[model samples]
Structures are given as C-alpha cells and as structure tokens.
Target: MNSFGQAVDASNLDKDVKSTTLHSVGDAAPDFSCRTTDSREFKLSAQMGRVVLLYFFSSSNPACFAQMKYLENEVFQKLRRRDDFQMIALGRGHAREELVQIGGEHRLTFPLAADPKQEIYTRYFSKYVPRIVVLRWDGSIAYQASGADYEGVLRLQEVLARELAAARTR
Candidate 1:
C-alpha cells in the first residue's frame, strides 16, 4: 500500500525498464548547474546543506508523465515549503523551451530544468526514463529509483523523509 493507503499495481510496469545508473548509494553525487524553466539557476553543489531531489524524465514518454505527476502531486505538494528541501525535474534530452512548455501545460509548481544534451542525465544514468535521485545534505546519494512504478515512488518518499529527519538532527 502507498502513503494514501491505495494498492499499487506494479505488474503493469514494464519489466524491461531498468536503470543503468553510474552512481550508487553513499557515492558522492556529481555536481552540475543549469537554468530552470523559471530562469532560476540550479547548481547541485550549491545545495550542499539541503536534501535535493533530482527527477529525470522524457517529455515524449507516457510512463514518464505518470511518474512526473506523482512527484508533483505526492512529493512536491508535501515538501515545497521546507527550506531544507529542493526538487528539480529535468527533461532528459529536452531543450529549455520544451521544458517550459511542459511545465506550463502540466502546471508544475517545482523547478523544471532541461538537459538538452543529456549532460546531467548521462552523469547519473546511461539509460531509463523517470529516474529519481535523492542527495543527502552532505552531497552524497541517499537513494535512487528507476522506472515509473509506485513501488519506486513510495520508496523515494520513505527515503526522503528519513534523510530529511537525519539532516535536521545534524
């Protein structure tokens, strides 16, 4: 069951969808900077003292859309007000203009970035859409998930909560 007490059907997820990620839990997250759809600069290194969530998706993938919706509705809504939390949804291989249009169409409230050349996305993973990476306050990777499945999304929420609590105590 998910946080909302709904049953998550994982059987519908594509079995072949897997993450070929280069980073692992406890590894230092790669730092990069980019301009968000809102014209704000986002630098991973600058978010050192905060828990950062990086969401990579493709605008052309329907499964990615589903995951994006979950992040926006379930994750973003609950954590947007936290000063120690930052979320960036990046369009893998998409240009800034495309991300801006997508943000407007989806009414996304969080920062939307564009990785037109896959520069940022390639640093984390070589394949897979709807990938999520959670960085600890100290710039290490705390959690990562691949595919647009509820199980992954739920796990991300759990990891984020735990990481945030741990950060608060530091």
Candidate 2:
C-alpha cells in the first residue's frame, strides 16, 4: 500500500491473481463456455470474429427486469439485426427453467444463459447486479459497468451502437 492508501501495482502478480481483479476497459475478456437457456452451447472463443455483449443479472430481480426492458427496447432491437454482434443475458442464482420462464415472460429476443453456479458472474464481476460487459471482435473489453440504471443503460445503448458500427467496419 502507498501513502495515498492505494495498493501497489500488481502487474507482476501471478496471472490467476490478476484475473480475479475486476476487468478493466481494455482487458481481454476471460473465455467461458456455457449452455444457453435455448440448450445451445456458447463458447466465447468461437465469438472471436464478432462483437459480444454479456449481460449479467439475477432472473428474479425487478431491477434486472428493468435493465432488460431497456436493453430490449433500445439496445437489442437494433443490435439483434446485425450479423456481427451477439448479446447473451446470463442469469445468476437462477435455474435453467426459471431463466426460460423469464425469457418467455419478457419475450426476449436475445439468448438467455444460465449461471446458476455463478461461475461466469464471479469470474467477471465481484459484486452488483445488471452488470454489462461489451467485447470487441478480438475479445478485448470495449465497455463494462456494474449497474444498469436509466442513464447507464442509455449510455450502454450508445456504446453498443458505436461498438457495433466499429465491428461492422472491421
């Protein structure tokens, strides 16, 4: 720790230790594999050529529902039509059946993935719900945030639009 009370640089720490830290803007997103609520396999490595947006939330939370609604109305509607982009809503602390039910209830257009074990959630973020991680085509993070309030979602919408445009041009 320094006199300013900040921990010293950890760049030289073990890779595993570094990975546990919150992912920053330019960090390469950790690759993960999981089954979508639709029963299809999703491998992060396979998405290397496309932009990816990973939305982490609890299926039972109303705030998460609001976040999804904003994403559905403003973000997904536009991004879903693109060929070079994919958005997967990952449900933490929710069963596969619950995730499917929520998706059906919301008429969500994007795929919903289950993280009942919280493996994916713990790997990316330490706390907070409705977190969003936007990845570029090469797998580096373009944008990331822990909360999805109205303004935050709006900003995310803009970021997604800009990232999608950049991905298409690549």
Q: What is the C-alpha lDDT of each candidate?
A: 0.84, 0.79
Pairs of colliding residues, candidate 2? none
lDDT of 1 by residue, 91-113 (tens): 99999998888888888888999
Tens digits of per-residue lDDT for model 2, 68-94: 887787777876877798889999887
Q: How accurate locally is residue 170 in candidate 2, as Cα lDDT from 0 to 100?
A: 84
RMSD of each: 5.2, 7.2
Residue 46's lDDT within candidate 1 is: 94
Residue 77 in candidate 1 has what lDDT? 91
TM-score of each candidate?
Answer: 0.88, 0.83
Question: The CA-based lDDT of model 2 is what?
Answer: 0.79
